[model samples]
Target chain A: MEKLRLGALEAGGTKMVCAIGDENGTIYEQVSIPTTTPKETIPKMIAYFRDKGIDALGIACFGPIELDRDSEKYGYITTTPKLAWRDCDIVGQMQEALHCPVGFDTDVNGSVLGEVTFGQAQGKKCVMYLTIGTGVGGGIYSNGELHHGMLHPETGHVLITKRTADTYAGRCPYHKNCLEGLAAGPAIEERWGRKAVDLADCPEVWELEADYIAQALTGYVMTVSPEMIILGGGVMHQEQLFPLIRKKLKEYINGYIVTDELADMEHYVVPASLHDDQGIMGCLELARRALENDH
Target chain B: MEKLRLGALEAGGTKMVCAIGDENGTIYEQVSIPTTTPKETIPKMIAYFRDKGIDALGIACFGPIELDRDSEKYGYITTTPKLAWRDCDIVGQMQEALHCPVGFDTDVNGSVLGEVTFGQAQGKKCVMYLTIGTGVGGGIYSNGELHHGMLHPETGHVLITKRTADTYAGRCPYHKNCLEGLAAGPAIEERWGRKAVDLADCPEVWELEADYIAQALTGYVMTVSPEMIILGGGVMHQEQLFPLIRKKLKEYINGYIVTDELADMEHYVVPASLHDDQGIMGCLELARRALENDH
Candidate 1:
């Protein structure tokens, strides 16, 4: 029996990762390249994956994508903050280069799929995955499936509570005090006038960061009520931020709606089991699932 | 062949409705009563349904309820804004009074189910039902099932942009500037010094109200990306608000997401099809579904 082979791409705002893997999410080969111009970068990705002997490919990318079921332009990356990649025909380009079926979706959705298939949310019916890096992106899983509609969920931009005395004019281009503006890594750096990693030891910065995260999580808890919430991204590396965020979430949520799961706060909010490789692994899983359905 | 008899109860903060219906969602008999003491109100509701000879009972009430699969207290009303209904044994009381298998869920969830089964969202996969009454509440349906997890979705409390410059302390005791605090009927009355019904003709009030609502819907659009959004509630009687809200949503969303459904503003944001009877009809539908699943 020939082993099922899959190619995975984790496309971020600043970088792109190309990898070849199998059904088990085991990467046999991988490469990371800086994201500059799509015209310059996509060719290198195609060159790298050309000889991988992959049967299928998946791209986990930032959106908004043209995923309308009725539209002729479905599976095209429509608009993105990454200026060089706007209106980029990612799926078409990948299909032309590889001559194989290409599966594409938002990076967060891919991560949720990866988690549900092989990570913490294995048996869960509903889960929420939040990646807090340059920006806060979220993926929701409802009834064992990725939550998809006309477009993907841009939960990072949901509006959140603002402090009265603290007047930090948030960094998000969209809505000034939205969750991404208040809790994202860039927001932390802007509010304190230093990089988040530089202030890892600073008590005041952590306190404020934890407060903003707790507020955002409070809204998520009230709005989606996921069985489990998986927190990832560069900011979570601090490790110390988790306990403070969990503490503050309990304080903010109150006991208005009590449950045994929430009563044990330590068990509810948890770090991603797959760590940094979740996006790439998720893409591979997406490809496998799509290929299975196609046959 | 005997016709299936279904009992339905629409339990709101201020009122309670009991009805008998069939699988087709046609009500044969119904009763409306003030939401006074739960003991008094629940007994009256049970008496009404019992007198009509219902085979199964569905109670769609304000939540948070115990919906967990393994919980012994499943279907009980846990917490609600209605002071008299807090910690009330709603399912137990009704089951004892009527001597029938009971189905219970949030009123908003019931409304969404009704829309999915018999109204506008009949075949849609992802739908959102938002009610803008004394307070704003919403129900989310994803992948053909009502979205529920830890407790339930409290979308009304999600924070929104504070558009006005004046100092208007929000009405909600929980989160001051949350969506309900800024845009609910009480919020409108407090800001304009008159009831929303009284200010329907005032362009200034509607514009401000539209601003707040559009801000909230912008967040909703970004977070959920529902196929169709159904709006209902007492305050929505001012039909003029819909167009104003749709225009503002386009401005706020800013074309980050491109969808044919949303591109035509007038068609995407629509009013509920069931009008005043949606809640009661939804509860009846819920009861019928539960009965069908039991077999």
Candidate 2:
């Protein structure tokens, strides 16, 4: 029996990471490319995977990707913050360049898949993965499958509860006072007039950030009811936010549904175990699933 | 082939309705009982179903119910506003009394299932069903299945983005200013010092209600990104609120994600097709599904 060889790609707004891995997600080779125009970035990505000699490829990209159930253009990147990638044939380009079967989904979805298959949420029937980075993104898994619908889940843009005394107009172009507008990286930068990293030492910023996040999590808990909520991405790297989020969730939940797990606090809300590799590993897992279905 | 015999129960805070139906959700016989203590109500419900010769029963009840997957007490009504039914073994009682299989879930979940199976969301993979009654409740459907998790999705209790200059303490015990606290029927009554029906003649109340609802819906849209949203329940009887909510949604969403479906405001956000029967019929559908799985 031969081991499954797969290629994984995590395409974000700022960078692209490509890796070659076995079925178990053991990366043999990898490369990172700063995101540029599709013409330049796509070619470089193709070149990296081409020399890797893999059998299948997967992509986890920032989206609103056009997903058609019956069409080969299923995984094409349709809309993205990256100016050059809008309406670009991402899956088609990869298939044409790499000459292999390809699987694709949003980075959050891929990250969730990776977690479900090999990380924190492994063996969990239902889970939600949220990445709070340049922007907020989320993926939901129910009954052991990634939730896909008319479009991907975009939880980050949800509205946040505003405090009476605080008045920040918000930074999201789409929604002036939505969660992203109030708490995303750009929103924090605009509100504080400094980068998030610079404010890591500021207790007030983290306190406010945790409040917004905990409020959003309350909504997610009330709506999705996932057994575990895996929080990831650059913003979540701030270790202090975790305890504050849990405390706020407890205060907000109000003992409505008492669970021994949530009573423990450590069990209900936790950080993503895979860290950064979850997306790429999830891509590889998707590629494997796609290949299995094909055969 | 024997036609599957199914029973449906729609358990509202104020009333309990039981109906016998076929696989197509056509009601054969129906009965209504005022919601009272569980000990008093359970026996009447059991006798009614037993006399009707039901093969299986489905229950759609208000939450927060204890849906512990690992416990036999999964569908017990844990904490509901109906104080008389607290800590009651809802599903177990039904199953024991009637001597048949049972399917149990939240009323909102049943409503979404009804919409997905027989209403406006017939062909859609993801749909959100929101019932604005004494309190606001929502059921999320993704990939043709109702979403369930740690407990159940309690979307109504989620906090909302405060929009108005007026400061009225919300009614919800969990979050004083949550969406349900601010926009539910009781909230309207509390805010205006009159019943929602009495205030229907006043456009000022409806305008504020619409603003709050639109803010909550905006959060829902950004978080869930469902293909279609179906609004139902008693408060929605005021047809004027629909247009107000739609207009507010457009104003809140801006033009971030351009979809022709959403571009046409009238088509995307609309009323639920089944009206009051959604919950009962959905319970019938759930019963049918449980019977199929049993076989």
Candidate 3:
């Protein structure tokens, strides 16, 4: 199993990052392909994996994927803003071309799986990975598996209470002042009239940002009860946000769940240790799991 | 399995309802014992099961009971309000005396398991059972099992936004305006200066109650993505609240998740069909499962 070859694809709207890896999370070969259309993009993927001669492929795809394993459209990416890829049969095409088992899930779920398998959440049974960049999306990993139900958790859209001092009209078109609208990087820029990286010097700006992230974490904590929570993406580069979010998370939790993880804020909620490698590494794990489950 | 005799105990603060049943959820003998102290109460349970000749036992106990089966205090009723039974070893004593595989869980969790196995949520893969009673508590059953991470889900204590139209200060001493504080039976009684049963005629009261329940349900739906949601408990007895909650849940979800279950509100959000038998029936299923898992 450790020596088995796996193909990892971090499928995105802009591009796809493909890597030939192993069950042990080592990447042997990698390539990036531009995403144009199904015809243009999928052939490039098939060519990459075919050349690699992989045992299995794992796709950390940009979704609204049909995650229901029993669904006829199980591998089709439905209703994505990437109009060209909408309703595209990504997994089916890859599986047919590569002639191997394929595991597919949302990118965020992949990142969490990566973290859980080999990164920050190494030994944790229950964990959540949240990416707060242009949008707020998250993945749930619990009982040594990624969560997929009606769909992978639409975490960003969960409604949250807004602060009294904030007057900014939230940017999310769907639900205004939702966790994503109030806390994501774009929300920070819209709220402070400056980018999050630039607004770091202003202490109050981060305080509010941490407040929203913490509130969202509280909801996730109550629902998923993750053993550890990892925060990633561009906005978390501030470093100051880590302590602030952890503190506010404990405050919001209000001592209901009395455990070492909840009491010790310093280590419970932290940054994604894999840095930029979370997706590719997670995809590799997914590939490994798909191969194992297939057999 | 259907021929095996099982013991079901609905352990409450005021009384303990013990029943001798089988895998088919048929109760042959039953009795109510006053919950005075372990000395008086537990012997009655042992006596009941000893005579019944059961193969397994299930205790649907009032909690903060130790749900963590691996912990040293696995079956101890920890920090309960019933003064004498704070740390009562209910499961341990029952297992020792009756000498059968004893299953134990919180009453709410048991009710949900009951629904999932033999009642409303039968054949459903993912479901949430929320009881908006003296307090708003819930149980989650997904992937054909009860969810117990960190602890069973403490659904009632979650934070929700205050509706702009209402200005009632919430009653929960822990979190001021959490779901339990805002929408529980006591909250309604406090707000209207009457019991829930007395206030059923007021259409607006039920509307507001439905709105708050809908808000909490929205959070659950987003996180759990349950296939069906069952509403039970005393406050839900107000039959008018069902249609109102279903309508409001759809409105709050706002078509974010497109599914047959979400589209059909009438059949999706429903009342418990088993009526007063939810606890005992769930316990029977629990006993049956414990025996199966044990073997």
> Model 3, stretches more than 4 Å misplaced?
none
Using all chains and alpha carbons, the TM-scores for the candidates as numbered come to 0.88, 0.95, 0.96
Question: How accurately is candidate 2 docked according to DockQ?
Answer: 0.66
Per-residue lDDT of B220 in model 1: 74
> Per-model i-RMS in Å?
1.9, 1.6, 1.4
Residue A38: error of model 2 in Å? 1.8
Superior by lDDT: candidate 2 or candidate 3:
3
Model 2 — TM-score against the truth? 0.95
* Share of reference contacts found in each model: 0.59, 0.75, 0.46
Q: Is candidate 1 or candidate 3 better by lDDT?
A: 3
Off by over 4 Å in 2: A51-53, A70-73, A164-167
Best by DockQ: 2
Candidate 3 per-residue C-alpha lDDT over B231-257 given as tens digits, one digit per residue, 9 for 90 to 100: 888898899998999898888777777
Candidate 1 chain A weakest ten by summed lDDT: A252-261
Q: Clash pairs of candidate 1? A: none
- Give the least accurate 10-residue stretch of model 2 chain B, judged by summed lDDT: B253-262
Position B13, candidate 2: lDDT: 80
